[model samples]
Target chain A: MIDLLVISPILVPLLTLIVCLIPRISAKTSDAISLTSAGVLLACVSWLLITVVSHGTLTLRAGGWAPPFGIVLVADTLSALMLWISAFVAFVVLIYGVRSGPDALSPGHLHVLIHGLIHGLMLGVNGSFLTGDLFNLYVWFEVMLISSFILMVREGHHSQLPGGLTYVLLNLLASALFLSGAGLIYGKLGTLNLADMAAKLGALQDPDLVNTSGALIFVAFAAKAALFPFHFWLPASYHRAAPAISALFAGLLTKVGVYALLRLFTLVFTPANGFSTTLILYLSMATMILGVLGAVAQYHIRRLLAFHIISQIGYMTAGLALGGELALTAVIFYVLHHIAVKSTLFLVGGVLEARTGSPDIRHHGGFYQSSPLLALCFLIPAFSLGGIPPLSGFWAKLNLLQAGIETGRWLFIATALIVGILTLFSMIKIWNESFWKAPASDHPRPATNTGGRPFLAMLSLCGLTLVFSLGGAFVFRLAQRAAGELADPSGYLDAVLKGGTL
Target chain B: MNSLLLRIAARYLSWPLLVVSLWLLYRGHNLPGGGFIGGLLAASAFMLYELSGYGRPQRGFFSISPFFFMPVGLGVAVLSALPGLLGGAFMKGLWLPGFELPLLGKVHLGTPLLFDIGVYLTVIGFILLLADTLNDESS
Candidate 1:
């Protein structure tokens, strides 16, 4: 049902939070609801993905108010993939939180805040994916951002204060820009709905105004995605949060931003603005180079991985900017691949930090010697992120490179290769420092580090990463098909406009 | 610190501002004001009262957790959207027969109005909640 597609994802978590508010329920009860809700969401998303994949885009108009007057939740292949990914990541994190020990996040309203953030993110992601209206997307953006703000500020670390401040200010500025862009689009087009705007955009008389609106909107997504200039906030804030939370943040948040950029540029604004394509390509290259460089310079494992996230984000954009069947297909594949690899690295990094009682790489060594299993767990995804063969990252990269080469983009192909190498470099840095070397001294380490549970969680995530890599054929093909669907937005526009499919 | 003009202004300003904001909230359906603007106006009115120290309700000062209200606002907003699914489509503005209020004319109220009110409470709750947190941090 359209209702199940749009509302259930959000409804499930919100219901759990309400149950959590009651005092009679203990931690066990809340965990059951939270975990069960995640499970239901997973089941729903899995079925929905297959349905949307077989059939074309599906639309659920809010209140069935028809086009230009109502909010619509439309699911195509790409959005479905993203929804599936978010649900999958959240489910795994919930698993880790349960199986692992006490969640290390500060405890004042922590549970509520965590659950609330999940609820908010679930709504925001679905709304962004499903929405066919610009304003509706903005509302979802606010929902997601407010949730992130709470998570960012919750622990109240001295370090987090500036990071949080910068994050708040930057995102607020993006919000304002987003609002003004919406106003401009609404004022000029006389319609805020996405599909309607597309029709109007194609026939626009004033190139400057339309181009300006398009640029502003892309800027908003860029800021959210943390592309190059917009990316400084990520490493700072992502590094400061607790690991499980960091794992979630690293995995899901920026991808939403990228997803928006991909959706808007590929579907709505691609025809109106050609300059955005070239501009985004150059920015993507810069983001890639700088992100990898920034990662290489960092010693703290998570911070390094966080920096590399932006670099890999560049790969996703590369596929879109090149703008052909292969390139778009590649972008979709890269997006999915990066989501898995980045989250694994962040979580594994967390596991390492947890075991060692420090995040700095130089402060520790010989993890592989003692906790050989955990070291091996960290190695899989790290190597995969570097694009070693048979890994998902490799398949994702090969496609992007192939897209670039086929388009005769030598420089981009070369840059993608360099970034891939650098990705390997940084991952190796993590490996050599944190896991590979012999211990410097005879100091005693924690029992948990020596014990195998935390390592097991990281190992489980690594296993998933490997699955994504080995099974890259299936997901990459889905991404290719989804990207094809996105390249042509006519069917999507019509489906949402009329209640029934076109 | 209280002044006669200041007190009169504070008393009049708070209630009037509150009233106007509420007006904005109701009229948002077809007017310039909506949940966001109305909530902000209402919040500003209460903020003025807090600043003027007209009522020294320490308990009131910290009564409702604003941070907590943000999620509540979110819940309200989401709940407001739930009625859409049962309808023929998503967000289809469900309605019952128009009920006549005592003073006003035929108010053909619907879920949009409920959604608006949810937006109102959420905004009011969120603003004050953030304000409360920042205040606690500073003091």
Candidate 2:
């Protein structure tokens, strides 16, 4: 029974994708199938989380083959937590996508196809989180990239083509780099199973080959995670996709990259290697500062939010760079908090665009006067993202800041603080222009009846943000336990290699 | 392109190619031949038929839209895993007891064969979809 739960995240989405692909299924039926599957996934992941909490690490060997030989799916506290949060986010986003009506970007016939792609995306995300092999992770990334590419360009608008092309080309480049890195690792270590690699990497005499491969993989994941130099594709492409897709991408995609970095760096490429850790540290500072500066220059709401996504990724990387039990805790906590807050903000931006007839804030006004609830919905996540106290983002940042201060990384700490301020500046800019500013003569007042399913989606996420805030201590403790597991992956290794019994 | 000799050859050769493809798929359990190669072989046969002025080959085995097979194939592949889950681990091959056949001596059936069949259909569907798209472009 527990074995089934471990694989259900992948299986549920896989089944949904198959169902969605059935010809002649109405868009409504596809919606029902996808939404119900997402709900089931969330329930299964939640149960998996409980099991992980009680059982330590759960590992399933495909075909019952012993690991170091067969493919394994390992779910530790960290993976389970990541899975639970992503499942919840996916469910809420699907609801928002359905209730928001037909996507303005694509035609009605494409609705079912989009759901199919979304399920594909979920399958990739879940597989990436759960796979215990490096090569398997790469395959999952391909699945995710294919689905995301279609989701971005399915409308085939002329304006979307350039962004879509850039997105695909850059990501393909990343995939190539990733494949080569895995190849290099396999050639040296003679195994792609993560636990086996971890065990062998420690015993290897010369560290240079491992470090080189680690650097290559780090660069690839940095591109996916939108780290400083490789972040161009994110701002170029994210805002051009459908609003719900942009929200989904913002919530899940880069975070998968971060999760990979966390898993590999902690487990295989330890700080003792001295290359990846230092590189991540310096690059993260640059990513934070540059990302916020980019956000400050954007007038388009979604584009600005896209830049903030990059900016916030810096904090997560910063926590990973800090390198301790507390820092890893902060990284996990920040990831959970950011996925909810960033996606909520994007959803609010979608609502704003739908109402104002533009994503440009310069043309928008009177939202506070017209719809206080929408305004409030926007404010909670925005303030939380800006790191206001008692909110989820505050605790997330606070934990990281504590870690940074403890490590005496004063330069990195200062960069984080400055970036936090600039993030608030950008958020306030959106507030002033879109909400507090007087209505322009050309501006249409947003429709007042914000009571339906769309609002329900927003309210549910806002409610989650509140829960994150109120339950910050509880979530932090969870993060700490997860961090402890990550900090010492011996439990994970034993679970996989020794055939952990459910 | 509409040579009578080519058309005659296509008509004679297509059925034989399909039979050989199925033989390959069935032999894949212990031998090297498998669903992927067999599916490619089967698709090539249809492609040859279409190339010989058949114009999409709409009759008998080729009547339905190739796109229809993708979901069915994927569904079958997923179903094959369920029996494995019931017995023990997922994707574990569970076999039916072997039975004697008239000429082949004995045959063992299993979920893996079902899985291979699913892959076969999916590959055929995928290739035909690509061919169909290219055909539309050219016309």
Candidate 3:
């Protein structure tokens, strides 16, 4: 029964994808089915979180085969927390989609495609989180890329093709690099199961070969996560996607890359040699500095948020590089906070775009006077993303800063603080241009409707962001617990290797 | 490419090609051949038939929309895992004992075989859909 619960979050959405694809299913029906599936997934993962909290880690082997041979799904605290966050964001995205996405799809057959895309995305995200095998992780990445590729190009906009091309090519290259790295590890250690590899790699005589493979894998993940030098592909591609897609991608996609970094860097490869640690430290500072600079330069709403996503990734990497229980706690908390805050901001962008008929701040104004509620919804997440006090990001940033001080990484600490202030500047730029300034005569101020479905979607997401703020103490404790589990992966290994029946 | 020769060959060759594909599919569980190879073979035969008949091959048995096959195939593939849920796992294969049949010597059935068939249908549907779309795009 527990085994059933562990796999249900992945399986239910997959079943919905298949069901929604059946011919004659209308868009309305597909939407309803997807929403129900998202709701069901939320409930299941919330239960999974509780179970993992109480019972260490839950492992379920597909085809009932034991680990080190067949694929295994392991839901440790980190995986459960990530899954729960993904589910929550997905639920909100579904509501946002109903109001914003109908006209974006290609009408009849494509309706089913949208639901399938979401399901495929969820499957990949959850699979990546829960699977204990490296090869299975690659397969899940492919699933995710395929779904995202379809979604990115589904609207067939002229501007989207270039973005889609760049997105696909870079990701495929990353997959190749990842596959070779997996092959290298398997050749040396004879195991692709993460737990087994973690146990075996340390004992192998060829440390350099293991390090090489680890570097290859790290580069691939960095490219996926869009860290510093590898980040050019992100803003170029993400801004061209549909706003809802941008939200989904912003909220869930790259974070999967960061999650992989957290999982692999801590558990699989210890980074004790300081090779990865030093590299991560330098790259993260560069990423933070460069990303905020880019965000500050952007006048496009989605583009600015896209760059901010890159900057925020820097904070997560800094946490990982700092390498303590507290730092990892910051990593987890920042990830959770970023997912809600970023997605909420993007949804707010969607609402703004709907109201003003432009994504550029230069073309719009006076939202604060017209709809203070939208302004408030936008401001909460914006302030939180900037690491303002009492919001979730402040605590997340504070934890990172404390860890930085302990580790004596003064440079990164300074970079993070400066980035926070710059993020505030960028957010205020949006405020001054879009909400605060009076509307110009050329671009007439549209009547605001706070009672509409779009506003309601924004409100719900705003409420989620507020949860991160109001429940900060509780959330911080949760992050601390999750980070403790991540710091020691023995429980994860034991659950997969010993708890299952062959 | 003599029209008459191509037509003769396509018409005469298609049936045997399909037979071979199905044979490969049936032997897939233990042998090298499987649903993916079998489906490709069937698609090749169908494509051959279409080309030889001037891209106007009429539907002989299945007349539903071509999109029907893709979804149904996926549905079957996912549904084959249902029995595994009963066993407290997913995608775990369950088998029935082989039995002698009237015409065939022996018949074996299992969820894995059902899964293979689903894969086969999906591959066939995928190739056909691609062929149709490309063909539409060209003209």
Candidate 4:
């Protein structure tokens, strides 16, 4: 029964998706299936987290088989926390999707793509957390990427056409590179389990093979996370996609890559592979600098947010690069804060676009006057994202800076501070242009309605962001424990060897 | 919009290209070629058809674009790992021992091969899908 909870969050949604595929089901029934599945998943994920906290670590071997044999789903505190947030956000987004009308996409097609994407994404995130295997992580990455592509194209708007092509091509190339890396590793070491591989890798004294294999794996994750050079396709595609769909991507998909980078760097590739930490730290700084610079240049509100996603991801990578117990803990806190804040921002931006009829900030003015409630929702996330005091985002940044100062990485600590300032600037730019100013053009405006169920849902998420600020000590402690666990890889390997005794 | 050379290429290259794609997929596990390249090859086959008859109403436009195939290929590639996940180590190949075939060498068949085949279909399918969209714009 306990093991069932581990798989239920994903399995239930998948089953509902299948049932919804029945062509004869009334639209009402389809909506019911979707809502019920989301509710059930959220409930199960919450329970799983509670159990994990009490029981140390939650492990389930799929179909009751043994190690290196059957697929396994494991949930640490971090995995459990992310699972809950991802599903909860999707539930809210689905509500927005339904309200937008059945014809927001190509009728039945939208439902299919949406359901498939949730299932795949949940599976990918869950697998990333649970699997003690390397190749399995790559497999989940592909699943998430494919599902995201379908969601992107479910709406065939002309603007999306070129970006869609680019997204597909670029992701495909990344998949290929991932495959080549996986293939090389499999050919060399006969086993693909993460814990097992780490043990074997530690035993091998030859530095060259270890470094080569380590770098190969790093390249694969770098491509997926869209670190700096590989990030070009994300903004274009994200800006072009319909808002709700992009919101989901903005929130969950890239985290899979970041999660992988964190899990791998901390656990398997430890004892300092000479260039690995420095390489990640150097890349993280560059990714942060470049990402923020790109965001500053973008005029479209949606595009700016997309660029910010890249830069914020850099912060997480940098924390991981710093490679200390406190730093890893900061990475966990930052991941949660960013997910919550980013999801809220994208959803609110979607609603704003819904009201203003354009994502261009220059075109949007006096929007706040028309929809004060919507403006309120946007403001909470905006200030939170800029690391305003008492907000969850501020703590995330504080921890990262603490990690940097402790590690004596003065440059990154300085970079983090500057990025925070730029983030404030960008947030203010939107506030000044859209919320406080007057409309610039005579474009027929959409009715700025932020009331009723949409209001309740958006309000609930906004309140969560605020509450997270004041009541984050428990999570901060859990994150610190997890990070400390990561900095000491022997604990992870010991857990596996001793049937998760740790 | 039709040209004699385009028709000749469509008529002659389609099946042969398709066969070459399958061959690439079959040898992909131990060789340089795999699903991505194979898919592109098969997509070119359909592009040939669209080229020969720019006016032809094909069965699908948006469905087969590399956009669609890209996702499908990725899904198949990922799913192929299920066996290893359940039975052995991650991505440990599921080898069905080669048996004698009518024309080919002892057929070296496995899940990776099947995954490669799926990749072949998806790449070809998605590429053609993208071409169809571009073709629609031109006309």
What C-alpha lDDT values do all the predictions have?
Answer: 0.76, 0.88, 0.84, 0.73
Model 2, range B37-89, lDDT digits (tens) per residue? 88899888878777776587667676557768788888888888878888888
Error of 1 at B117 (Å): 4.3
Better of 1 and 3 by TM-score: 3
Q: Model 1's A-chain: what TM-score?
A: 0.94
Candidate with top DockQ is 2
lDDT of 2 by residue, A1-502 (tens): 7678889999999999988887888877887888999999999999999999987888887877787888999999999999999999999888888734433324688878888899999999999999999999999988998999999888888988898999899899998998888999899888999999888877774478777888889989999999989999999999988888899999999999999999999988886543458778999999999999999999999999999999999999988889999999999999999999998988889888888778899888888998898899899999999999989989999889999999999999899899999999999999999999987668665553433666777789999999989999888899999999888888888898887757
Against the native complex, each candidate's DockQ, computed on alpha carbons, is: 0.36, 0.76, 0.66, 0.05
The number of the candidate with the highest lDDT is 2
Worst 10 residues of 1 chain A by lDDT: A99-108
List runs of model 1 lying over 4 Å from the truth.
Answer: A14-29, A98-102, A180-183, A205-210, A271-273, A442-444, A449-460, B1-77, B99-102, B105-109, B120-124, B127-139
Residue-level lDDT of model 4, residues A286-402, one tens digit each, is 888888888888878888999999899899999988988888898998888787788778777777777677888887888688779878988988898899998888999999999
Least lDDT summed over 10 consecutive residues: which range in candidate 2 chain A?
A98-107
State each model's C-alpha RMSD to the native: 4.0, 1.6, 2.2, 7.2
List the candidate 4 regions with Cα displacement exceeding 4 Å. A100-109, A272-275, A447-451, B1-139
Q: Highest TM-score: give the candidate number.
A: 2
The alpha-carbon deviation from the true structure for residue B133 of candidate 2, after best TM-score superposition, in angstroms, is 1.1
Report residue A256 deviation for candidate 1 (angstroms): 1.3
Kindly list the per-residue Cα lDDT of model 3 for residues A1-502, writing each as its tens digit. 7777888887888788778767778878778888899999999999999988887778888898887998988888889999999998888778777623422434666877788888989999988998899999999888888999988888788999998899899999999999998898789788889988887765664557767888889889999999988888899988777777788999999999999989988877676422357788789889999999999999999999999999999989878988989999999999999998999898888777767777888887887997798899899999999888888889889999999999898988888989999999999999999899987558764554423555566687778778888898888888998898778777666777787422
Question: Which order, best to worst by DockQ?
Answer: 2, 3, 1, 4
lDDT tens string, model 1, A160-275? 89888888889999988888878987887888888887777777756676668778887888888889889999888888877777888888888998888888887667844433
Interface RMSD of each candidate, angstroms, one decimal: 3.7, 1.1, 1.7, 7.7
Residue pairs clashing in model 3 are none
